[model samples]
Target: MTNKVIQRLGLLLAAGTGLWGQGSMTVTDAIRKAWVDQAGLKAGQAMVDSRKAEAEGYRDLRLPTLTLQAQGVRTNEPMMAFGIKLNQARIGMADFNPLVLNHPDAIGAYGGSAVLQQPLYTGGRITAARKAGDFMAQAEAASQERRKQETALAVVQAYFGAEVAEQALKWVGDTETWVKGMEDFVGARVNQGLMLESELQRLKAFHAQVDAQKAEVVMQIRSARSGLGLLLGQGPVDGALATPLEPGTPAPAAAPARRPDLVAAELQAKAAGEGAKAAKGNNLPEVGLELGAGTLHHSWSQKGDWTWAGVGVKWKVFSAPDLAKARAAKAQAQAAKDMQIFKEQQAEHETRVAREAVTAAEARYAAAKDALAAAEESRRLREARHKEGLAPLIEVLDAEAAVQGARTLILQSLYELRVSRASLDLATGTPIEGVQP
Candidate 1:
């Protein structure tokens, strides 16, 4: 085929659309334009913020809590109690002073308390809590990266799908035109008594075949348009008026080791290890600081005061086979690590295979093109010979069929190469430099 035919295929693309730009969009633009809707991205960001909040809350475990106390209470009976040390002796006594009483029979309640307590030590409980929060935050980050990778892959497939379908449609259109021309030429020969009626009938059958091919191409084009729309976070079959397909070379190295999904997997594996560490650390000491301000109404007729402050430490005295549980967590982490490695290996292998496939497909397409060119030249010679009365009509007809068949094979081969290149791009997790920021 000539460049003119390829140019016609592109002319149908909306010039205003990303699909028909003078140059194909960079991978970064395609990813953003096709995937990662604003709403979904915002939601992802909110999740990250939530993770940060959780981390911050856990960080508070290492700091003392301070609070002021104030309370208004009325109680028919004692609502709360605290023992007092009188003269170095612990005395169990209810202060029934009216100033603290909310009602009769209510333990006397008094002044408000300003409570403050700092963690003395926790058997690694606080540390584990904090670490867990940190791990969660890290996981959230990884999840975001994974989202990016997923979107990129989706865009790659969809964008190229549209491009391929457009190409197919154009090729089919051109072939149909050529088939009609052949039919006309054969019919003219028959009218001139130079071709048989059966030959004319054969041309009609060929025309019918072309019609069927056209239908298939139309369907394929519609499907591709839908796929592209879906990637852009829009309804299928709703591609913008400006949407168009453009042809270009895919940069093989654009996919790098830093594919977002791969990076995310690595981070997730690390987070899993952190979780395992935190789980094991649960066996150690945990320190806590508690501070509260609240008042108790001790009397039926009197108001109560608020006062509070405390600090505490906890040591996990004993547990049932915690070692086994911790070991399980470690094992889980190891499994995650293995999975991450496997994913990387899989991506690399697929990329290499895709590269080879693309090369092979290209070779096939080139061979097919050459075959079609040869077939066309042969058909031309036969037609000339038949006009000169030196060749039978059958020979010309056969030559035409060869040309058409070769054209179809050439188109199919080119399509396969494009599809394989797309697959390779998806496999490699696209180059880090090609990724959107």
Candidate 2:
């Protein structure tokens, strides 16, 4: 019996430590790990990269384009044969004869050409296109940052959720231990004929109830840990989480900063405006320079070569389709500006609500602390009174229940406070709990 009691005590000790024995991680560490591992964040980063590449492509439109062409052709038709011979510089005085020109023999020529085209001006079309692309890329980058912040917020919830479950399990274990001691005491009283047998039976029933509650808490702990693991981009984690579920320092009171999503919306609006400008630019004149060099050879040893350079200008003058496009672009720009305004307002509302939530959580935590203290003292008094036969067994059990309730409330309030702080950080575009990258 002595060995059994010692072993049970040791097991309880191990359970307490085992909740966090495998590894330790701070909230900051978990967020950083999630940022690197989370699939959603990775996808968002890919989108940002794609947008940046597109922007580079748009910017490269200002660079000249060079093209190379090669072809071989044979023809017996008079005009085509004569043209090929002229281009190949194989035409002779006899080739100019009307009779020979009308009935030319089949001839084959191999031709290769290199052409370079440089845009001299296109009104503001290229400039606006490049600017629009740059702005859109910036918007995507901002949106990605917002995604990271959201992922961090999720990590906070999962990390602390596991901690809360583990902490609650420890408390439930304490309740179980207390109920067991009561059962033993009551059993001894009934054996001595001092307390009714029914009283001992009641204590045994309450001990069993506590044991059931402990089992439920254990299941909760496992579930919470599994959820945390999934959020970390790993499957179920067997290692104990290092961060404890507890209240921390409150966030400094301040006005909310511009959130990343809001910035993205603003940038998107700017991009749309630039797109409108680019669309209108399409109606203006375009000027360019073209350079060409080519060679035609009937035989490699005897080839003809030519080079030419020229400037060209083209004007749409009046195209109904181009006019409609410009009008549609203008409308789209207006719509984007409106959407940006709406997003700013929405962001402001979210920040205000998050601040209120933090305030409410703080108040709840303070009240819970007071209730926990009173409930603990009340339980102590009831237990002491019951020992002296001043209080009934039921009253002692009720007191234990009250203490348990108060402790649970305290834990819940602490969890809420921590979550509210993180929520506020997210709303204000702050790093989660001020954790820096």
Candidate 3:
């Protein structure tokens, strides 16, 4: 049978075995599955959730705090004994005698108090802290988005890689079958005295080479499938193509405004700036109001109740550590700003490169398609000439090889074009759903 017939038969057998049947997976479906099942993406989302919870906790600082406490003491010290009596409202005029004060008896007392504290002012420290929490939460959200885009890019590459490898394997298998048929034809001609034994030997050697190439292509397909499976959180998978391999739509003229990583960097820089502000606020005074209601009893027979309200102020008049910390925070903020600028520049460069790659890939794919058509025409003409005794068998074999090589190039270019489009989407931070491929 002719090589084309054999290849068709092989495809029929493959289909019967379900390789290209209903079990096929589309690239879009694979990406959707990975988005739902990928462990790395899940972990990133969890981190965002954790940061959001932390930010919510920080925002609670604007509310009042309440505390309850109980205490007991017994001492012969004059100060402790007098204070205990005063708290229990059990102090007597005679208890002020110098003799009792000099040698006071041991006294036991128990007290409990419920206190509420409300911050009145914190030199903007509280506000800065809340803002920092918000910024950090934004940063985490951006990071999660970055992770999602990365995962989508990874899926696109792997899906295309698997498709490329599958096509290579199929092409190589077809070429191998064609070489085997040539070897048998040459062997028969040699036996019939129409071809030399050396020609048949050469054909056999070429057949062996094709076989080895087929083996390599098989391995490539296997490896590609394994990698794609891992990315999809499946151990391994094998199937025929469900999505057509083609170059996607070109990117828009203007790049996307918010690449995930750049957004994350900007938010992180803002968070750092807020932290610096909070650090500086450490040197300023803080004011708060404290309200308490309590009961104290020196004995079962004696008890007293009291309520107090007061304003409190705390000022760090001078502290070397606080100054150093403020300086360090400012330096960190500066570093973050510099990093953000660098990231922005890098992103712009990457977007430009990816756009160029897409253009180049489109050109290459068009060229490869033309070359494949030309090679097939050459192969058909050479085969016809050989059948008519106008061309040598070697010339026919060479033309066939050229056709196979051109087909391989076409396959590669097609997949490369797809990959370049994916890269462009990634560079621009286009959402996965926005990716045409």
Candidate 4:
């Protein structure tokens, strides 16, 4: 079978496997498949989940914590020995004697306690931490959205690229067929002494050129298929264009805040600001309520249970390290804010550029369509004139070449137009499904 026939069979198989349809894969379907198959998108979603889990952990800090602890020790030191006895309610007059206390025999002490601590005040540290966690989660969520958009755009480019390559290959094949017919016609004329042998040779050379062009286009089609397959997390696939290029109106300019990347950047800055607040909390006093119930034993023979409750205050009056950390956090927050502003500006610029590209591509595609029509009409006239012996074979060949060139331009311009539209949708923060044409 010819390579063209084999390629067609491959496309049919691809369609049967649901990678694409008879018309080729639609942009919507491509985007949907990519969302489900793309490993990068899955990883992005996992990161969002991780951030959500971290946020939940931070939020849990507001609840009281209960802990159980146990310790055992054997000591002969006077102070420790006496304290153990006292805790066990086993103290005696001998423990008060200086010599007896100083040279007391070692005694084993064991203690188990359960304590509950409730934070009454943390100088807004917990609140700030929770806010930071929430902001971080939001940032991750935004980042995941951006990743989806990017994946959709990539699918658009690859899908259309394959379509254009397929069309170009078809054009080359048709040109080759036409040239072959011309060669046969000219060879008969030469045999009849009505055409020169040089005419047949020229036709043969044109056929060779068309064959070379066809080979290159075949490779391009394979490469395009490979790219699309990679984006869909599959092996190389072959398909045809399911939908024609229909350039739609450009999307209106959207605020930078609507862009997922810009939103993520803004959230990151907010998280950084919360981090600064949490760091400053280190300089303030922390207060909490602590309650404990425990039993102490001396030699396992004497034991007593006791309950105690108290309010605790912790203050870091002067810590150089904490001060430096707070300052660093403030600087980081400032930097994050600056980055957010820059991202907003960049988003706007990108959107504007994408809009311009779409406009230009649409215009080029329109012009190419018109040129193809004119070229096709001219080729028909030239071929008719050649049949009537009123035009030279060379003129007919030139018209055929013009027709093929116009077809090539049409395919390329259509590809560019579709890709530019996808880019504009991405820059405008429009969902893939919502992107028309």
TM-score of each: 0.72, 0.89, 0.86, 0.86
lDDT for each of the candidates?
A: 0.61, 0.80, 0.78, 0.79
Tens digits of lDDT, candidate 4, 1-437: 12343344234223211223334567788778778887888888899999999999999999999999999999998888888888899888877888887799888889899999999999899999999999999999988888888888777777666666665667667777788788888899899998779878888877777776676666666666677777887777766656555556646544533878988999999999999999999999999999999988865767978999999899999999999999999999999999999988887898899989978988898898999899899999998888777998788877876776677567667767877877877887876536422
Q: What is the lDDT of candidate 4?
A: 0.79
Deviation in angstroms for 116 in model 4?
Answer: 1.7
Scanning candidate 4 in windows of ten residues, the lowest lDDT window is 12-21
Model 3 spans > 4 angstroms off: 1-22, 72-78, 92-107, 248-257, 299-301, 387-394, 433-437
lDDT string for model 2 (1-437, tens) is: 12232233223222221121136777777788778887878888999999999999999999999999999998999998998888888779999889898998899899899999999999898999999999999999999889888888877777766666676667767877887788888888889888999898888777776666667667666666666666667766656666656765655756655788999999999999999999999999999999999999989888889999999999989999989999999999999999999988888898899999989989998998999899889989999999898999988888877777777677667777887888988988887867765
Taking the tens digit of each residue's C-alpha lDDT, what string does model 1 give over 158-187? 555556556556666776786677678878
Model 3 lDDT per residue over 122-233, tens place: 8888898889899899999988878777777777777776666666667767777777777787787778888779887777777776666666556556666667777776
Candidate 2 lDDT for residue 101: 86
Q: Is candidate 2 or candidate 4 better by TM-score?
A: 2
- State the TM-score for model 2: 0.89
Report the error of model 3 at residue 285, Å: 1.4
Candidate 2: stretches off by over 4 Å: 1-22, 96-103, 238-244, 251-257
Clashing pairs in 3: none
